[model samples]
Target: MILAIDAGNSRVKWGWHDGADWASIATVPLIEFAASSDHINPFSITHGDPERIVIANVAGEGAHQLLVNWTSIFDAEPLWLHGEAERCGVRSRYDRPEQLGPDRWAALVAARAVHTGPCLVVNAGTATTIDMLSGDGVFLGGAISPGIDLMRFVLHEHTGRLPLQEGSYRDAPRNTLDAIETGCRHAQAGAVERMHRAMGGNPLCIVSGGAARSLLELLRLPSRYIENLVLDGLARIALSERAVTR
Candidate 1:
């Protein structure tokens, strides 16, 4: 059995897979994590113990410790995943490969598994990251920009007058709130579209992260959504290591 965890900026997603299929999968907002990690169990209270646990953490130290705290009760220590030069057929193009976010790297690995051809990997969450991958599994680096929520948040935080809450996305917004939201969506969608165009051929756009659904309808390129690809890549990495060791 293998456990995979993706600790993103705003939430934490986890799943446990037993070779053939996932035994369990769940997500918890970071707001609830302090209590969940410290008091209640974050992974699984029922599953005996995971043979291997792989994690991709981009939230920060607190999240790093949460995994640490969970693995304390088990015999196996969690393998904290970081971006590398190459792994599982995907090679990175980042100038400083390790500097690339782990979440992004995991998504690239997942892209390699899901899309055999070139792909534009888009993860729209606290921050939206769009990365390009060549057909042969070379991770041609991409871009990062403010997500829909982050765009709204910055407007609310930096400026005066704008409300802190987000409004609905509109084609032609009637009011201020909707206008802000609509503009934000356009930017998010535009980034994906631009990346797809840059890839120059019709490439599969494998989308994930919290805002994936919102961006799905707006994107012009062929797209598919995987709930949390970071988790999928974690599972891939774990299985690869198991095969090597065996």
Candidate 2:
């Protein structure tokens, strides 16, 4: 079995593949990750030990320690994944490829494997990333902006009066909470729509991340939501690595 982990800013998603298909998949909320010792045991307890552990982590120092602890628990050293200049049929267009977030890079790699045409990959997790991939597998790059929650939080924390509000998406909202929520959603959707147009107006848009569903209905263009693009990418990278070694 192979353990594929995508540790983002807000959550840690994982998948177990028995060299064929996913045996199991799950996620751990990062809020409780620092405090919970038992959360990492489920995969091992239920599926036994993984032959290889791969991770694409962008959670910073505090969360990095949590992943380290997880590996220690299993006596396994994780194969930390990075965005390189080129790998797994995807070429980076970034000035410095390594600077691209591993999550975005992995998603692009996976997207190329499945998408044969132009595609815009939107990963709306802690941050909303809009990356464009050409039909032939060139990472043309996209946009990165504040996610819905972070947008609300920034307004509340940075400004003196705005409160942390909760509501739903609306084009014209009445309440303060709803207005804040709508604006955030609008910002996210707007960015996505803009990218879609920039990508010749009809690229295959693949949306992923926790807040994907919230923005799905608002997007002007149609999109397909696959909840685990990062994990899927990580799994593919793991497979490619093994093949190269053998």
Candidate 3:
């Protein structure tokens, strides 16, 4: 068994897979653990003694220590993943391959594992990232923007009059709430579409993350949503490492 963990800006998502398929998947609200004093075992969401525990943590030092403290109970010491020039059939074309976010790197690896053709990888969570992966397995760089909620929060935070509230999408928003929602959704979808166009080939857009459903409705391109993509990629990396060592 392999336990794959993706600690992002807002949440820590994990899954258990037995090489063939996923046994279970769950999320731990990262915000809840603001301090080490607020102890919550995120791993208790499911019971599994995984042979390997692989993680891609972009949540910073505090979260890292927390995870280490929790996962220490398991026999498998965590295998932390970092951005690399090449791994699991994906080559980085970024100016500084090591500086690329591990979440993005893992996503690219997972995209390559599932799709053979060119791809536009989009992960829309606290921030929306649109990455390009060539048919030949190259990480061709991409773009990042504030996610839907962050967009709304920024407006409310930076501007005094703009209120942060829920709203539905409309072709022409007549109210403030609708306008905010519509504009943010369009911005996310537009970034995805623009990256797809820039990639040129008839690439498949592999979308993931919390806000993906909203973008899915707005995007008119060839796109499909994959839940826990980072986790899947972490698992793939783990399996690859095991094979290499053997």
Which model scores highest in lDDT? 3
Q: What's the C-alpha lDDT at position 2 in model 3? A: 87
Per-candidate clashes, comma-separated: 0, 0, 0
Residue 140, candidate 3: how far off, in angstroms? 0.8
Give one digit per residue, the lDDT tens place, for model 3 in 177-239.
Answer: 999999999899988888888889689999999999988999999888998789889989989
Q: What are the RMSD figures for all models against the true structure? A: 1.2, 1.9, 1.6
- The TM-score of predicted model 3 comes to 0.95
Badly placed stretches (over 4 Å) of model 1 are: none
Q: List the residue pairs that clash in candidate 3.
A: none
Per-residue C-alpha lDDT of model 2 across residues 47-147, encoded as one tens digit per residue: 77777788898988877777777666665568888879898889899998988888999999888877878899989988999999998889997899999
Count residue pairs with overlapping backbones in model 1. Answer: 0
Query: On a 0 to 100 scale, what is the lDDT of residue 104 in model 2?
Result: 94
RMSD of 2: 1.9
Q: What is the Cα root-mean-square deviation between model 1 and the actual structure?
A: 1.2
Model 3 scores worst on lDDT over the 10 consecutive residues at 33-42
Query: Whole-model lDDT, candidate 3?
Result: 0.89
Off by over 4 Å in 2: 38-43, 73-77
Ranking by lDDT: 3, 1, 2
